[model samples]
Target chain A: MSNRDRIEVLFWGIGGQGLVLASIILAEAVGVYEGKNVVQSQAYTAIVRGGTSKANVIVSEEKEILFPQVLSPDILVAFSQEAYNANKGKLKPDTKIIYDSDMVKIEDNVPFKLYGIPFFKIAREELGIPFAGNVVALGAFSAVTGIVKLSSLERALLSKVREEYHEINRKALERGFELAEKLN
Target chain B: MSKNVRLMQGNEALVEAAIMAGVRFFAGYPITPSSEIAEGFSKKLPRVGGKFIQMEDEIASMAATIGASIAGVKSVTATSGPGFSLKQENLGFGIMAEVPCLVVNVQRMGPSTGRPTKPSQGDIMQTRWGTHGDHPIVVLYPTTVPEVFKYTIEAINISERLRTPVIFLMDETLGHMREKVLLPEPDEIKVVNRKFPKVGKEDYLPYKPADDDVPVIAPFGKGYRYHITGLHHNYKGYPTTQPEEVEELTKRLLRKVERVLDDIFILNTYMYDDAEYVLYAYGITARIAKEAVNILREEGLKIGLLNPITIWPFHEDKIEGLLGGKKKVFVVELNSGQMKGEIERIYPRKDVIGINKLNAELINPYEIADHVREGLR
Candidate 1:
């Protein structure tokens, strides 16, 4: 797992689910706060919402990030059933698959390590904000992978979101971290 | 002082650089992959006393940009594949009228309206000869986010200096990718403004040539009343049909850029000094080629990269020098052998292998590495 210096992460969900924003914050955490090289790119349908969307981010300790697209991602965070189904062919035997258990139901038995968290449920019931699911997924992913520090993620989120909405997101992130820690 | 390090996309960098380069007006239509430029300008331009207008379509946007430039304002417009096609007629008009403006084409996959979100380098030839007839234009391509910012300013500078419309060519990959960029301080960069006429109103020729064959552009309605048209024009900017007048104007227009090719052409070479194999690419493909060269070198292959920063007015001499003593040169691009055609013209006898990818996906580094290994074997 540590053979390569670069780490690729893919965030997949329907549009308007904040997957793109999550990818941007995650990239900012690693690239800006952690001072590593990063490239973040996204693909989505022409529709504004309820459309398949995916964001690919590559974080490298190397001086340069050559390819911006993630052909094979080390970590896949799925927020929708459609996203999981769409990316099933890209799954490798050792790849880590993280999905929202409340949103996606997996029928196929995959060889990779699969972890499910109720991201939407926690965001709505625990954090009182339904849109904070993306931040919760970020925290859970960080806790599971240990790729980027939670402090760095917090700082990146603070910088990205509006000043008025910082406290709610902070709570959402902390709840995510706690949930991931309990699961691990 | 603001911190120089900031996370920016290629489109954002272009807007920031244009603003810093004293661009006062932006007119553009929103299109996929390239729409961020218009969005960025809409917010940033107003703060700096500049104006941004989302025209009804690409044609109006290009015409309005030319109109702004004629009023002594540094103007810019951006678009993707189909919009670029719609813009070519007015782009040619800007060339003939010698209107200094910048046209940014963040290319997407297309012959017509191919792919809105996908990246392609298919517009290389379109930019060079898209408009009708014989005319000279400058086109700049940048591979990195930092180069996107730098070359955008360079595009504005060249346009103003040469009094010609400059095409700032970008791919959808670069346009959408986000990266960390250390923007230079405002005073750190060289900003060139257009040379306005200094003569009194009695002796002003709107189409008169300066020492470098580029005419000094005087803004319209500024007490310098002169005719400006797309037709063959004489020294006073009046329409001309005589053989000498038309011949001289055409020659001077082409000569202005041809004579200063050395000043405009920019290229970057990596590991070429002791390399046996060279990979020639531009834009996003060059970034991938750099990695491929690195991986092959670690495996002990003498591979190098020749990245063309200026795509138009092809760097023939520099490319020839880099190809010296190299056994094979792989021309890597996102289009089906667009740049490879130019390279073949330069080195007719050499083994110029073209690794072309046209499926709207980036050429991966592993693919390039494997090709190098195969070529060596």
Candidate 2:
């Protein structure tokens, strides 16, 4: 019901930034709406608000997911300096790394492709919804990687979030797509 | 129709299935990973006119679940490793009293509170013999969300039919991981209610075994009055000191599950027809081993997976049939070869190799594949 090759993605940021939700949104789009078998998990702990958190999503069109966790990620989205530092040295040469431009600053000596999108800035200043940055990042992820369609991501987000926050989240997602397209 | 196909966690799926299987009482002390089961029960049980209680401790949770089950409702409780340790004593009480309840242990790394957020199969030995007795227990180790859903119903049915506590095992990884599951419609499910006493109050013998070796005990607060104690009991349900009665009662407890292993066993296999080697695994390790089998098969190697969905009351007869002519069996687990020992007890240790991993991280498919390759070379 889906492609044969597996596509692995990782979302990393501080807790409460909604990276876990973003990963789930991407998983829902790929697995539920798009008909692939996917397994998504997050690093959980006693604290839910402040540590370096990670969400790993593996999309496989295989009959069953043999290895549930992402062994190597095709794309890595970082929202904090800690996220970048902890995971930057462990990427394959062709891995796509996207970091929040306003949140993390990196010198360009890495082997993989790096795209810095101002996810938090767009969510805070342009969209007036600070907490919608994860959706913004999801939009950027769709535009940059072309793994999930923008429509799929938007539908997933709309289906997951409440009605009051849908407008700003959609705007945030669109702005993410626009910025990512401009970067390419 | 509302969307049955949605993303959910393993714990959430189990609770949903339990409700469908007629589980109406949940008494649990929330712990990480397994806490979602309690949380789901808390939210959904009340909506269905059931009861959900956050007990003071895991022991109380087990006691309360047993109490509720004996009070004429299907009951369940969930806990993690440390809490599982705490519930062991009362769990034995449920076994001796022949109460039907479900105890879900979502394991984390631990002898104590080792790692709350990490995964472990450390409870493999504990789940079998944790309580201090020779009594039989039915323990199911499900690897995925869908299995959790299906086997939750199966577990409730088994416990109801057998009149014993069923341990439903999950780990931190499966409990927390999200997967897209198509929830089964209610009509597709067959709920098993426990056998209640048919005789009037005068002739009811609470501990008298029927043809199936299961006692149709009367529920508490009913018109029937009888003794229910942890001590060795007679057919009259009172504590007994007679050695023959204790032997008969004890033997009957085990015969309940042993006689029907065919009905309770669920062993999942992949590509077993022509495989030369076996990857023996359970829980999340089985999921990884299944992947390792696929990866090795792509390399033109004949490898297969023998996954035990039911971990305890080891289905030796079925497993023996599956592993008869295999070249080598690799018992892969998240702990230090707990089930490897069990497998070795059947097959010689020389024929069974152990692949062990116990840190917070999961052992990937490559690690398993590499083990097989290294062993072959």
Identify the CAPRI category of the predicted complex in candidate 2.
medium
Q: Give per-residue CA lDDT, model 1, range A12-57, as digits (tens).
A: 9888889899999898888888888899988834857888888999
Name model 1 segments beyond 4 Å from true.
A1-3, A85-89, A92-94, A105-111, B375-377
Provide the TM-score for each candidate, comma-separated.
Answer: 0.95, 0.96
| Weakest ten-residue segment in model 2 chain B by summed lDDT | B1-10
Error of 1 at A167 (Å): 1.6
**CA-based DockQ, model 1:** 0.50
Quality class of the docking in candidate 1, CAPRI style? medium
The TM-score obtained by chain A of candidate 2 when compared with the true chain A = 0.92
Residue range A1-184, candidate 2, lDDT tens digits: 1224787888888899999989999998888877888899988875568777899998876566757776667888999988777776777888888889888887777788888988887888887888888888888888898878888888889997889878888888888888888887
Model 2 Cα lDDT, one tens digit per residue, B1-377: 12688889999899989999999999999998799999999999999999999999999999999999989899999999999999999999999999999999999999788988989999999999999989898999998888888899999999999999999999999999999888878999899998878788998899999999999988889889989999999998999999999999999999999999998988888898899999999998898888888889899999999888888889887888889988999989889988888888788689898888878678988889999998888
